[model samples]
Target: MSDHHIVFIPAAPHYLPTEQQVSSAKAALWQWIPEAEAIEAAVTEYVQFHDCGSNFEYVRCHVCGQELTIPQWHLLMEQDYDLERGFGLTPQTLPCCGNVASVNQLDYSFMQGFSRFSLTAINPRTGAVSAQQTELLQRQLDHPLLVIYCHV
Candidate 1:
């Protein structure tokens, strides 16, 4: 069976929660975020979360509408390496078409990322936590949050 995870990260690197803070955040998550199962702190710089079974076919070049291979997409992701801002792979020059494009520009079927913490809700009935709820959680924790979708 496939699984979907909505990983949450702090907007700033410095905003990453401390161990004690994680506890408080866990409480907030349980109280507010629907289907929140647990809050896990990352031991490494980034957590490599991947899709369970979906294969990434290809991504279209935002510039020339060219359909590029998955490896080409990975090249773009490698170029834009800022993960602290949530969606790490921001817009950059597409090697395939040489045009600036953001992650939102790519038509990708799956996503993965490195994060300092993850709030996992196993097979949540609601799919994902809402932006409003995340915003509220951010306020409660006094840290801006970035949410990324992962299927595994």
Candidate 2:
């Protein structure tokens, strides 16, 4: 069975909203997509990549626009991943342009990102979020958010 998820993450990988902020955001999301199966919010100990699952395509350098192949991306991720601390999210030189960029800074084809905190809705029936709703959620969380749709 396939499943869909609507994920919202703060733009800053290290940002974690306060409990009140999270509750406000959750309330806003529930009001916006009341039919959703479930809403889950989490604040993690370290920055973690929130991928778009099967919706993922490719990642490219934000500065140079050079595509980073899956293998190259994997190598970079492996180098940065720490068993105890999670991803370092540090800058690495791109093989194509020699420009430095972090994995979190890459342009994901499917709107994926890295964050220490995330809010996700399971099967929100409603498709993409509207611009107005996005803005409202941002205000509730007091942080700019990245909306990601994941299919699995």
Candidate 3:
């Protein structure tokens, strides 16, 4: 069987909300996804990738909009990662456009990203979140948000 996840991450990769804020966001998430099997928040010491799993399609350059091959992206990922420290998110010159950007800056087909913090809903009753509902959660966290849908 496949597992589905709704992962909410801050727009800034390193941003960590206060405990009270996280609690508020949790409450709001429960209200929004009442039937979810579980909802949890995490603050990690190192950056973690929030990926779309089987839903991932492609990655595109933000500047040139050219498709990036898997190998190209893998090389970049390797350049940015560390065994003890995780991703540094350093900017690199793109092969296609020569534009400098981090992996987090690229356009993902399924909203993948790197983050040190995340709030996740596991197997929610609903798959989609409305813009208004997202806005409400963002307000609770007091930060801009990126919502990722992952299927595994």
Which candidate should be chosen as best, given TM-score against the real structure? 3
Per-residue error at 104 for model 3, in Å? 0.7
Error of 1 at 125 (Å): 3.4
User: What are the candidates' C-alpha RMSDs?
Assistant: 5.4, 0.8, 0.8
Model 3, residue 135: displacement in angstroms? 0.6
Give the 10-residue window scoring lowest on summed lDDT in candidate 2.
Answer: 93-102
lDDT of 2 by residue, 11-111 (tens): 99999899999999898899988999999999899999898999998989888887888999998898889999999998888877888878888889899
Against the hidden reference, what TM-scores do the models get?
0.57, 0.97, 0.97
Question: Please, what are the lDDT tens digits per residue for candidate 1 over residues 1-152?
Answer: 67655566664433456676666666766665456454454534553333323544456765687787767776666665556643454567777767787654565454333445555544454556777888776775678766666565
Model 3: residues with Cα > 4 Å off, grouped in runs: none
Better of 1 and 2 by TM-score: 2
**lDDT of each structure?**
0.58, 0.91, 0.93
Candidate 1: misplaced stretches above 4 Å? 12-15, 33-37, 46-68, 76-93, 97-114
Colliding residue pairs in candidate 2: none
Cα lDDT for residue 74, candidate 1: 63
